[model samples]
Target: MNRYQVATAELASSQKSGAGVPAYLRWVNRGLGRRAAAVAYVAGLSPNAVTLISGMLSVGGMVVLVFLPMSALSAVAAMVLFLAGYALDSADGQLARLTNRGSIAGEWLDHVVDSLRLPLVHLAIALCLWRAGLPDWSVVVALLFLVLSSSWFFAQTLAGKLSAKAADDGSAAEGTPDWVSFAKIPYDVGTLYVVVAALAYPPLFLVLYTGLFVVTAAVAAASLRRKYRALLAEQRDYAPEN
Candidate 1:
């Protein structure tokens, strides 16, 4: 294979099968990520370099939203930057795999970018809405939404830890629901689209936001329960005689 094909194939090998992506958006993101990875690989860019650019663009987009006055044109620009950042986020992992230089540090840094970007986007939007002179209650809603969404990430971390313990004990915890992951796309990879759509129609966006929040909140609770239950089961397996 040529370099481009080689790079794309490497990405395919390393990539998950749309783990958290909605069905409709999966193909688009996959194509964008692979293409970007190919281009970055051909350009001899390191994975960390791609990651740094992604972080800068994503964070800078939020900075625009929170610090500047809201406007349709500005919102569109922010969405473009955020989407580019996300596409590059995908490319970084693929590039890492292609270079055989994937490391724990790179993984942690990628996640750190995501961890910050997710909550900050919500906070930025909340502040933007406040600056737009929306009610104080709307800002409160935004903050609450941010808290619930960030909690979901913490729940996933807990689940990962419990899964590791369960695996060590040879107890297979139940498989995670695909739809739960799909439902979270609006809050993650799909955030730019969500924000753009919301910016176009504020009242409708509130309803949709509430719906997403409810679904994700439910999924987080379910995930946490499963993880905690598995942890208890592991304890029981190792428990001493009464």
Candidate 2:
């Protein structure tokens, strides 16, 4: 098979095996991903196009966050837009599957957009908290988790970018990898917690911090552990014979 097929197979296999996604996450991902797949097939949008749509939906969610309280209505709107963004996130891959339009460039765009959303959203949340004169600790903790999560994402993205570059240049790639060997951790944990957060507190904003931070920490730990073992395996030289 060609590189495109090879890459796609790797991803699809990783997904099917739940190699790096938390088991509990499968509950939401199964449904959202399937729905995204359906929309992608019907809409004929490319993965990059889907990524752009996801970013736009997220910004729209941010707009709502700024204008409204963390009330039931606002929570619902934010949840809708957030899910829309996530649907787009899932759709990108599904579109690639349907149209055979997947590419390193498409993957690159998806990761870039996904990475940006967390920081920007956290900044928006912090701003809202400041505006409402809530205790500084919540926003501070959220931002801290956001930073940790962002750093982990950058590491993963850089790994992918390097892998793409290496494939372009015909060499080995660098940077931390996309998964922790066999341990699955869902990259979309923020959206995963949205419903739970909304349900758990009087205001949706209240639960966002603990939920995101704890999950981020778990994913990061899993990621680092995987990278360590993968490195060891990679370093062991395999001498081929005739």
Candidate 3:
């Protein structure tokens, strides 16, 4: 087999469980990431390098959104950059696993970038809306989105770590229905980027963005409660007997 083919095979074998992953991530972003990771592998690039590249691309998209005039072309450009960065975001971890160079530091860097970028994207949207002379409530919606998105990210990450620590098998309960992934489309970053691409049309963007925020907030509320309760149960189960 050719080197690229060999790299692809290796990455395919090392993929993490897809349970509960959104369809955009499972079906779209990860597929693009696998291709990018294979290319990175062939070029002998490190995972950290790939991660930095992803960050740069995302930042570039935000810059375009905040600085460039709102236009269909500009929206498309920013959307493309954001989507590419997200795909690369997935690529870095796959590359790390493929190269066996995964480290705590690398994972920390990835999460840090993600945590910052998620909020910043919404902030950029708010700025763009303010510049466009949209109503104050639209700007308010954007800021609220920033808050909700970051909070969800923090809670989800914390719950995963806590769950792993509390469980003996290092596994959360299984039997997540396959349809849950489809239901999570509204929560996907890819979906957000697609909504952000509607920036050219203020009315459309506001309607869609607000709708996404509502759906996300509802999902986050229910999911957070479930996670908190699950963690509490796990903690009680593992407590030392008197």
Candidate 4:
């Protein structure tokens, strides 16, 4: 609602100091907001506004692609809209910092909106491939990417938790996120390549989608094994002596 109210709401979920939002995201947010920089000054739009609008754009883009498969031009436009949506998604934290009003609702909603984008985009891809007479395997691979990517994120989170506990017990040093918030590496690279392939040549995207899925699956599996071992180790330390 207001500045003080927003800050109070955010106190529940605010990131710890030094866990600031990543710079690449900040850079994207700043660059894209410049699209409406003068207007933001005049209208006083905040980060959540930018984020929600971008989410809408991403959804709209997928809807359009689903129905307008005949034109490569339209597909290109949809992908571009989705990209803009992601850019605005990046803008939210910076917008909060600049405005000094951040809310947990805003932070949570940013992720909720983002979570919807990938599934919808995949649906659009499945529709496109059906038209091309591709095998169902393509859709399966796409789903694998989403599922494995999610598992990888969760596995990494567990690893961090374990590391922190070990540090607390004096078994190790305080753990940091592996690298500047996981580099958004899989997402930044996967989305760009997928979008490019979708617009220029749909088959190219299918190939990239499958390739990325394979790589991500391997990474997720390895990470899961590490997390499982960590959990076992933690449990062993707590086992009672007979």
lDDT tens per residue, model 2, 86-109: 767776776676567889898878
State model 2's lDDT.
0.62
Score candidate 3 by lDDT.
Answer: 0.87
Tens-digit lDDT track of model 1 for 1-242: 89998878877777665544554346566678788989998998888889889889888888877776666777777788788888888878877877898998998888888788777877887887788787787778778878976776766665565567532322222454567555556545465444544654566666766666667667557766766777787785664659
Total clashing residue pairs per candidate?
Answer: 0, 4, 0, 0
Off by over 4 Å in 2: 1-15, 23-25, 159-208, 218-222, 225-242
Q: In model 1, which runs have C-alpha deviations exceeding 4 angstroms? A: 19-21, 165-188, 191-193, 237-242
Colliding residue pairs in candidate 3:
none
- The alpha-carbon lDDT assigned to residue 125 of candidate 1 equals 74
Task: Sum up the clashes in candidate 4.
Answer: 0
- The C-alpha local distance difference test score for the whole of candidate 4 amounts to 0.59
Best by TM-score: 3
Per-candidate RMSD, Å = 4.5, 8.7, 3.2, 7.4
TM-score to true structure, per model: 0.81, 0.69, 0.90, 0.66
TM-score of 4: 0.66
Total backbone clashes of candidate 1, pairs 3 or more residues apart or in separate chains: 0
Best by lDDT: 3
| Whole-model Cα lDDT of every candidate shown, in order | 0.71, 0.62, 0.87, 0.59
In the range 1-242, model 4's lDDT, one tens digit per residue, is 75544543443244323332344343444455444432443367877787788788887777766677636777677767777776666556656755676798897787677666666676666676666567788867666566655555555555665665422322112353537534544444335433543655757676677765666667557656666766677885665659
